[model samples]
Every structure is written in C-alpha cells, then in structure tokens.
Target chain A: MSASRHRLGRLIGNAVLLAAVATTLAPLLWMLVTSLRPKQDVFDGALPSALTFDNFSAVLHSVDIGRQLLNSVIFAGGVTLGQLAIGIPAAYAFSQSRGRWSRWAFAVLLLTMSVPFVVVYLPNYILLSEVGLLDSHAGMILPQVASAYGIFLLRQHFQAFPRAIVEAARIDGASEWMVLWRVVVPASRSAISALAIFVFISTWNEYVWPQLVAGAPGMQTLSVGVAAFASEEAGTQWGSIMAAATIACLPTVAAFLALRRQIFNVLLEGAVKG
Target chain B: MAPALLLFGAFVLWPIARTGWLSLHDWNLVSPDREFVGLDNYSELLGDPDFHRLLGRTLMYVAIGLVGGFLLPVGLAMLTLRHAGRATGVYQTLLFVPTVITTAVGALVWQFMYLPSGGPVNELLDTVGISPVNWLKDPSTALPAVGVVGAWQNLGFSYMIALAGLSAVSPTLLEAAELDGASGWQLLRHVVLPLLMPTLLFLATTAVLHALPNVFVAIEILTSGGPAGSSSNLLYDVYSNGLRFFRVGEASAEAVVLMALIGGAAVWQMRLIERGVTYER
Candidate 1:
C-alpha cells in the first residue's frame, strides 16, 4: 500500500509538470497553427483543417520585411560586436587594477546596471535628436552598445583568469593589445562567445529603443516592424499577424535551440553568482 | 577602460544628469524656449489622482509578477527535483524557449490568444460551459492580462535559477533527513527551502524590480495601456509622456521618480540580504 502511494505521488508530479509545459507552450503552438490556416477559419478551432504558406507569402508581400530583418541583423550584430570590442578591454582593466579605485569603479558600474533604461531614455532621445541621429540605425545601436551588464559579466570571467599566462606573455615583450588578443582572449573564448551570443539575442529582442528611435520605415528592426503591423491590424487579419510573429521569432528561437548548452551554462553561472 | 567609460559617461551618466536637470524645467519638445519649474512637476504628480492610480496599478503588476513569475516557477523547480531524470533537460530547454523569443512577438501571439471572440483562450473556457470574458478590453482585466505576458516571458529565467539552487542543496543532507524519518513534504519544507533561501530572496527582488519594465513592451504592443490608461504603468507613462506626447520636462520628472523607486527597491534588497537570512549549512 505504501509503495502504491509512492507511485501515485509520482503520477501526480508528472501530471503537474506536463501541465506547466503545456501552459508555457500553448500560445506558441497556437501561433503556428493559426498562421497555417486561412484567415476566415482562424476562429474555427485550435487545429487548422488545411495548411497553406499563403499567410507567410502575404506577410512578406505586404511589408518590406526583408529590409526590416536586415536592419535587425545590423542593429543586433553591431551592438554585439561593439560591446565585445569595448567591454573586453574594460573588463580586463577592472580585473587587473588594484586598490580602492577599482572597487569604486566596479561599484559605479553595478549601480548603472540597476538604473532602468526608461530612466535615461528621454535624455538619450534628446541627445540623439540633437545630433541628427534620431530615426537612424546609429541612434538605436549607439546608446545600447555600452552595456554595464556585459562589462560586469566579462569582468567576472577575467578576474578568475590565470595570472601566469598573462605574465608569461608579458615577459615575452607582448604589448597590452597583443596580450589581450593572443593570450587573454583565446584562453577565455568560451566566456566571450557566451557573452556574444547573449548580447546578440538580447539586442535582437530589444523593442522600446528601436520603436522609439527608428521612426523611418527603412530603419525599423524586425521586432519593431512586426509590432507595428500587429498593433495596426489588431483584431482583424489574425493570419498575417501570426505569420509576422512567427517570422520575427524564428531567428532567436532557432539560435536558442542550437546554442542551448552554452546559453544554459551562462544563465546558471550568472544566476548563482550574481 | 577609457573607451567603455567614455561611452558609459556619454550615454548613462550624462543622460541621467540631464534627466535630473530637465525635471526642474518646463520644455515641450517643439519649443525652443524653456521655463524653470522647480518642484512644480513633482507637486503636480503628487496631487494627481491619475498618477496615484498608475502607481497602484504598477504595484498590482509587481504583485502579479511575484506570484506568476517568481513563486510559480520556484515551486515548479522544486517539484521537478523530485522527478529528476533525463527528461529534466528537455523540460528546461522547452520552458526557456519563451525567454529567448522576442517579447514584442510573444505579446502579439498572446494578443491573438486573448481575443474575445472564439479565441483559443475563450474556446477552452467555453468547453467548460463558461461565458467569455473580454480579456483585454475590460479595464479591470487589461492590466493583469498584460502583466501575465511579462510573467510568462520571465518563467524560464526564474525556473533555471531555482533549479540551480535546488541542485546545490546537498544530497547528503536530504539522505540524512530521510533517515531521520522525514516525509517527502517535510524534507522539502524543512531541508530544501531554507537552503534555497538566498536564491529565493534574489528572485523575489528581481521579480519586483523587473515587473514594471518587463510589462512595458506588452503594454505598448498588446494594449498600448488602453481602455483609458487602465493598463499603463510608471515606465509606460514616462514613454508616452516623454516620447509620444513630447512633454520632455514632465516625462523627465516621471523618469526621475521611477529611478528613485528602483533605487529604493535595490536598497531594500541589499538590506534583506544583510539581515542574514541565508543558511550557513
């Protein structure tokens, strides 16, 4: 009787866990299902009777989706590249420096991370407008490239890096730049790559900055463009909106699937330590 | 270091300082002229009933987020600990799918789900012989509906953190507790929760802090804080007033208030950690 009770408990546990999974995925599943059916049949049921690529075609034809997607790539890619280019050296400096000064600097960086983007967005917008960068890709990418979070993450990895490797490279008369590139970077490739993937995915998912800055049709990122389309179409045209959402979601979701292990590792480390 | 500081100073430090200054003046975006308005905006905000309602709604969102985002995932993570196996990896991967997806796109999909007429959510409700409720259109439900989208997106992150914490709870301790005749539920409550307290505290603090900002995209896309600003939060107010309406000074004031509230939250979190709630063993 006790053994059966334990089995019953296991059954209930599996049931609850599966329900959580179903609840989490039901919306995405609905999105794909609705995108396949005809627009008029969206309300028919959960499952589509027949599938078609017509909605995808209609979404592609209706807007300059290609341009928006290209913009997203450039925006996310630029921010990622720019962040690594700047954040690596900054993290190295923080890691190598000694004294209360570095501690103070790190404290300031931590404080900056906690300041919500909404707090500074107004002044940043005004600054961008003053510089004639508003509604431009530069405007969206420039302010975001300096991420305290990235610098903080990289700094943690750099702090734990082996000091002997750096000293050996220094003894060989390597310049600071050379040491960074040839020694430190190659040694910490995994961490750096993890940061890159994260920065890229997050920048791709950014909405408010792109929506606020990219007023021009040509400069809007994929997420922003899809959002505009979704809000404009609202309750009517469910098929096209779902198709746009599916298209917008595909890149990051695909990336997550491919890089799940690395992503999970970074998230686990960051969560436990931070 | 120099380049990073330069960029941070330009974008973050300068902008924050500028926002503080801008809050003390009255300047519409189009106007070339600026008038000094010391504390008037603050006083007005304090007096305004709408602003109070926005703050209350913002707190409501935080409460919902605490339950849905933090507590639910943490509880689920603990449950999965009992059924740990190869399939745990699959559950982790699938649950985290929403975290990687675009919030704007996810909100759009939920917009479809919450449609009043024969939407999937309503269809499921109808199968149980219940009447349809207008999810997004009704003022009472709009804020919670938008808040849930943020909670959903946040689930994977919180779940991963909780799972890591649970796994860190030493197996030897569990075995010892079981040897002491503790039942499964007793072991969970007496052994695991205390060991997991630090992680739980961190998750709680982040849930409160992230609630407002996380919901901003949903509010913008799903409802635009609609049905007469019923769903608007503090961040959305800052966006609409500053960017949309171009009331730069007033918006900056709102922004300043938001920063103070966030700063206060962080300080409280630090105090909570310093109070020694973490279990040594």
Candidate 2:
C-alpha cells in the first residue's frame, strides 16, 4: 500500500509538470495556430476549421516584412559583429591584465550596466539626432553594441580560460593579440558562439529602442514591423498579424531549440543581471 | 577597450549625465524655449496625485509579478525535482521556450488573445461555464490582465532560475533526508526550502528590478496603459511624459526617480548574488 502511494505521488508529479508545460506554451501555440488559419476564418475559433499559409504570403507580399526581416538579420548580425569585436578584446584585457586601468574599465562597464536605459533614452536620442543618425539603422544598432553586461559575461568566460596555455603562447613569443586570436578565441568557441546567439536574439527582438530610433516602417526591424502590423490590424486581422509575429519570433525560437544547452547556460548566467 | 569605452561614454555615461542635467530644466527635446527650473520638476512631481497613483500601481505590478515569478517557479521546481530523470530535460526545454521569443511579438500575440470581441481567453472562460470578461478593457481587470501576460512570459525564466538553484542541492543530502523518514512536507520544509532561500531572494529582488522596464513593452502593446491609465507603470508613464507629451523636465525628473529606484535594486541584487554565491560555496 505504501509503495502504491509512492507510485501515485510520482504520477501526480509528472501530471503537474506537464500541465505547467502546456500552460506555458498555450499562448505561443495559439499564436502559431492563428498565423496559419485563413484570414477570414481567424476569428472563428481556437482550432482552425481549415488551415492555409496565405497569411504568411500576405505578410511577406503586402507589407514590407521581407525587407524588415532582412533588416533584422543585418541589424542583429551587425550588432553581434560590432559587440564581439569590441567586447572580446575588452574581456581579454580585463581578465588577463592586472593593470589599474583595466580594473577601472571593468568598473565602468559594471556601472554603465547598472544604469537602466530609460534614464538615458532621451539624451541618447538627442545625441543620435545631433550626430545625424535619427531614423537610421545605425542609431538602433550602435547603442546596443556597447553592452556593459556583454563585457562582464565575457570576462566571466575569459577568466575560465586555461591560463597556462596563454602563458605558453606568450613565452613562445606570441603577441597579446596573437595569443587572443590563436589561443583564447579558438578555445572559447562555445562561449563565444553562445554569446553571439544571445546578442543576435536580443538585438533582433529589441522593440522599444528600434521603435524609438527607426521612425518609419521602411527602416524598422521585424519586431517593430509586426508590432505595427498588429496595431493596424487590431483584432480584425489576426491572421496576418500572427503571421508577422510568427516571422519575428521564428529565428529566436529556432535558435533556442537548436542551441538549447548553450542558450540555457547564458540565461542562467545572465539571469539576475538582466 | 578604447572603442568600447568611447561608445559606452557616448551611449551610456554621457546620456546619464545629460538626463541629470535635463531634469533641472524646463525644456522640450528640441524646442528653443528653455528655462532653469531648479528642482521645481521634482517638487511638483512629489506633490502630483497622478504620480502617486502611478507609483502605487507600479508597486502593484511588482507584487503581482513576484507572485508569479516566485510561487509558480517554486511550485514547478518542487513538482519536478523528484520526478526529474529522462523526461525532465524535455519538460524544461518546453517551459524555457517563451523566454526566447521576442517579447514585442509575445505582447502582440497577447493582444490578439485578450481581444474583447471573441478572444481565445474569453472563449476558454465560456467553456468553463463563465461569462466572457473583457480581459483588457475593464479598469478593474486591465492591470491584472496585462500582469498575467507578464507572469506567463516570466514563469519560464523564473522556473529555470529555481531549477538552477535546486540543482545546487546535493543529491546525497536529499537521499539522506529521505532515509531519515522525510517525505513530502518534512522533506521539502526541512531539506529543500532552506537550501532554496538564497536563490529565492535573488529571484524576488530581480523580479522587483525587472518590473518596470521589461513590462513597458508588454504594456505598450497590450493596453498602452489605458482604460483610464489603470495599467500604466512608472516606465510607461515616464515614456509618455517625455516622448508623447513633450514634458521634458517633468519626464526627466521621473526618469531620474526610476533610475535611482532601479539602480538601488540592481545594486542590492548584485550584493545578494555576491553574498549568496559565497554563502553557497
């Protein structure tokens, strides 16, 4: 009887976890379902009476979603590239060096990380406009690339780099840059790729900054484009709006699924700091 | 280092200093009209009834978010901790799915779901023999409705954090407790919950810090803090003040208040992590 009770408890436990999973994914699943239903029948019910992919075509064909998707790719890629170029080196300096200036730089990164973006939003806008970058992709991507948290996270990863290998490379007459390129970067591929995916997903999904900086739909990223699609559709055009949203969401979801372990690692690492 | 610092100054530090400077002056973003107000903006803000309401509402959001972030994750962690084996990884990946999707997109999807006219959420209510409620319309339910979206999106990340914390507990210790005749309640209270404290505190503090800025996207898409500004939080209100209404000085002052508030929370959270990590070690 006691053994049966334990089995019963285990049964109940799995059931509850499954329920949690179902609840968590229910809205996202609904978003996917809405995206595929015929436009006219989108309001019919939760389950599609009939399914069609016309909504996808409508979003891609009628709207500037295609351009925006490309723009998102470019935007995310550009920021990722920009950040890795700047942040990796900074992480190297911070992790390997015992210099006062390197310590000061890390402190600066941490300080800037603490200052939430809203406090500086207006001033950044004014500065961007002063620099003649308003309504441009540069305005949207540039501010994000200088991520203080990125430096901090990479520093964590860099500190875990085996110091002996670096010491060997340096003793063999390798320059600092040469050591970084040949030893550190190659060794830290997993962490760097994970960081790249993190940056890409974040910069791709950034709505508020892009909405503020990229004025017109023509210049907007996929996130802003779909948001605009939703407002224009309201409740009337759920199909196309869902399609746009699904398009905006696809890359990140796909990335998460593909690189589950790595992305999950970053999530836990960057959990509280974000 | 030079390049990152230069951009950091241009984007983060200089702008923060400018926000401070802007808070003291009565000037729009670009208008030639300007005046030095000398703490007038802040004094006026302190006396403002709407600001008070906004603060109260903001705290309400934080509380609701904490309930979702804290209880839901703890519940999930407790359920799956023992049952965790082969099936555990799959369930975890499923739950962590939401944290990856663009929140802007997530917010819009919620907008469609919370539709007043024949939305899926109301239809589900109908199936339960309850009448449809305007999830995003009624002032009484509006904030909670938006807050639910915040909760749903947050549950996954919080669950992950709790899981991370739960994993930190040694299996030997739990098995030892079980061998000591601990089951269910005693096992949890005596062995599990105490070990989870640091992580829970970290989650709670971060939840409070995340309340404002993160919810801005959801609120913007879902309600625009509308139906009488019932759902508006501090971040959204400040954004509207500065961006939409051109009340630069008042908005900057509001921004400063929020900055100090979040800055305090972030510092507290960092300290918590620092202490918690060492304590765990």
Candidate 3:
C-alpha cells in the first residue's frame, strides 16, 4: 500500500509540473499556431485545415520587417559591444581595488540598479534632444550602454578569478590590461556569454525606452514595430499580427533553445550567488 | 577608473541631477524659459484625486503580484526540488520561456487568451459549466488579470531563486526529519521553509520592485487604465501626464513620489539582505 501510494504521489507530482510548464509555454505555442493559420481561419473554432506560409511572407515582404530586424540586430549588437567596452574595465577596477573609492563606487552601482528609469526618463530625453540625437540609433544605444547589472555581474565574475593567476601573469611581465585580457576574460567566458545573451535579449525585447527615444517609424526596433502594428488597427489582421510577433520573438526563442543549458546555469548561478 | 567615472558622471549622475532640477520647474518641450514652481507641482499633486487612485491601484498591483508571482514560483520550486535531474532541465527551460518574451508581445498574447469568446481561458471555464468572465474589460478583474500575466512571466526567475535556496539546505537535516516521521508537507514546512527564508525575502523584495515598473506595461496593453480608470497606476499616470498631456511639472511630481516609494522599498530590501546574512546560522 505504501509503495502504491508513493507511486501515486510521484505520478501526481509529474502531472502537476507538466501542467505548470504547459501553462507557462502555451501562449508561445499558440503564437506559432496563430502565425501559421490562414488569415481567414485565424479566429475560427478549429485549427486551419491547411497551414500557409503567406503570413510569414507578408510580414517579411510587405512590411519593413527586414529593415526592422536589421535595425534590431545593429542596435542590440552596438549596445552589447558598447557595454563590454566600458563595463569590463570598470568591473576590473572594482574587482582589483581595496580602497574606499572602489568600495563606495560599487555601492553606488548597486544603488543605480534600484533607481527607476522613469525618474530620469525626461532628463534623458531632453539631453538626447539637446545633442540632436532624437530619433537616432545613437540616442537609444548611448543611454543603455552602461548597465548597472552588467557591471555588477562582471565584477562578481572578476572577483571569482584566481589571484594567483593574476600574480603569475604580472610576474611574467604582463601588464594589467594583458592580465585582464589573457587570464580573466578567458576564465570568465561563461559568465560573460550569459551576460551578453541577457543584454542582447533585453535590448531586442525592450519596448519603452526604444519607443520613447526612437520615435520615427524608420528607426523603430522589433518591439516598437509590433506595438505600432497592433495599435494601427487597420482592421483586425490577427494572423498578420501573430506572424509579426512570432517573427519578432524568434531570435530570443532560438537563442534560448540553442543555449538552454548555459542560460539555465547562468540564471541558477545568479540566484545562488544572490 | 577615471574614464569609467567620467562616463558614469556624464551618463548616469548628470541625467539624475537634471531630473531633479526639472522636477522643481514647469518646463514644456517647446518652451525656452523654465517657470519656477517651488513645490506647487507636488502640492497640486496632493490635491489630485486621480493621483491618489493611481497610488492605491499601484499598491493593489504590488500586493496581488507579490502573492501570485512569488508564491506560485516558490511552490513550483519546492515541488521540483526533490526531482532535480534531467527532467528538471526541461521543466526549467519551459518555465523560463515566458520571461524571455517582450512585455508588449506577452501582453498582446495574454490579451487574446483572456478574450471572452474563443479564448482558451473561457473555453476551459465553459467546460466546467461556469459562465465566461470578461477579464480585461471588467474593472474588478482587470488589475488582477494583468497581475496574473506579470506573475506568469516572472515565475521562472523566482522559482530558480527558491530552488537555489532549497539546494543550500543540509541533506543531513532533511534525513533527520524523515527519520523523525515527518510527512512530505511537514518536511517541507519544517525543514525547507525556514532554511529558505533569506532567499524568499530577497526574491519577494525584488519581485515587488520589478512589479512597479511593469504596471505601466500592464496599463498600456491590458486595460489602458480602463473600465473607469480603475487600473490607472502611478507609472501610467505619470506617462499620461508628461508624455501625452505634456504636463511636465505634474508628471515630474508624480515621478518623484514613485521614486520615494520605490526607494523606500529598496532600502528595506538592503536591510533584509543584511539581516539575512546575520540570521543564516
């Protein structure tokens, strides 16, 4: 009886977890289904009798989705590059220092994470406008280049680097920059890749900041483009909207699937460290 | 160090300082001169019923989000903790899928799901012989409905945090509990929950702060602060005032109030972190 009860409990547990996972992922699956359904059959009771690739073609061909996708890639790429360029050295300095200034600076960095962007949104807009960068890629990229989370995560990774390796590199006549490049960066690839994936995904999916800064249609990212597409209300083109959304979501989903293990490890590691 | 500091000053600190200055004056986008308000904006905000309603609504959003967001994830983490193996990876990946979707996109998806007709949520209800409910349209269900979506997106991250916490518990203690004839729920309540409090507090605090900014997205996509402004949160109110109506001063005042509320929560979170370290023994 006890064995049977244990088996029953295990079955129930697996069922519940599977249900939760399905509930969580159902919308995304529905998005793919809706995207493929013919436009006329989008809201029909049952699935479309025959799936069509026309919606994908329409989104890719009819709209400026190709340009928007390119714009998203460039914008996300530029910000990721910019963040690594600035964030690494700052993280290195914070990791290496044992002084009051570095300690205080790290604290300030933590404080920035908690500071809401809304507080400074207006000022940022005004500043970007003052510099004549409104409706430009530079306007969107400049503000996001310095992420507090990036600095914090990198500092955590850097602090975990072995001091003996740095000393060995220094004794071999390696400069600080050389040590960082050869020893630290190579050792921390997993963390850096995790952070890069995060930054890329976030920048790709970010809506409000891009919406606020990149106002013109030509400069819009995928998220903003989808929002604009939906808000236009040029009749209820449910299939087309789903197609565009699916296309917009494909990169992140593909990235997650490709790097599922690493992404999971990074998130779990972050949670553990926190 | 110098270059980093210079960039931070130029990018982060200077913008924050400018926001402070802008808050004290009435400046429009087209105006060349700044009109000195001298706390009139804040005082006027105090008299605005809409601001009060938004604050109350924001608190409700936070409360509902905290329960659904943190509790559901914690429960999932606890359930999955004993089964940590290859299958766990699949569960975690599927769960984290929602967090990666754009908030705008997720909102649109949920908006369809909550549709009264032909929506899966209502279809399930109909199978149970219950009447279909208008989720986003009704004032009563609007905020909670949005909160559910927010919770769904956030569940994976919080679950991961709780699982991390659960993993830190000493296996010997769990064995001891089992030997003491502890049932499954008792093992969890007595052995697991206490050890997990620090991580729980951390997750809860972060969850609350994250929920605040999200209210704006919820307002935008789900209800548009609709069904008689029941869902007009502080963030949406600020956006509507400053961006839509160009009431720079009023919006600045609202922003300042929100910062205070969120800043207070941040301070509380820091204190919790410090206390967690001390209490871990």
Which candidate has the highest DockQ of all? Answer: 1
Candidate 3 per-residue C-alpha lDDT over A1-274 given as tens digits, one digit per residue, 9 for 90 to 100: 6567656666777788999988888887887888889877776754677799888887776679877887798889989888888888889989999999789988877777787776667767778889999899888898888667778878878987889989999999999999998889988887888888878887888887888889588998888898888777442776777888887887888888897766666665544454
Report the C-alpha lDDT of model 1 over B18-88, residue by residue, as the tens digit. Answer: 98898888988779899899999889898999999989988899898899768898778867876555678
lDDT, candidates in the order shown: 0.85, 0.81, 0.77
TM-score of each: 0.95, 0.94, 0.92
TM-score of chain A for each candidate? Answer: 0.96, 0.91, 0.93
From the highest TM-score down, the ranking of the candidates is 1, 2, 3
Better of 1 and 3 by TM-score: 1
Residue A143 C-alpha lDDT in model 3: 83
* Reproduced native contacts, each prediction: 0.73, 0.71, 0.52
Best by lDDT: 1
Model 2: CA > 4 A from native? A99-101, A272-274, B175-191, B276-281
Residue B238 C-alpha lDDT in model 3: 71
Candidate 1: count the clashes. Answer: 0
CA RMSD of all predictions:
2.4, 2.4, 2.7
Quote the positional error of residue B95 for candidate 2 in Å: 1.2
DockQ of each: 0.67, 0.64, 0.56
User: What lDDT is reached at residue B130 by model 3?
Assistant: 86
Which RMSD does model 2 reach against the true structure?
Answer: 2.4
Q: Which has the higher TM-score value, candidate number 1 or candidate number 2?
A: 1
**lDDT string, candidate 3, B116-227, tens digits:** 8777688778889989999988888888888788777777777766666666666556545544553866876876678767778887887788776755665777777788
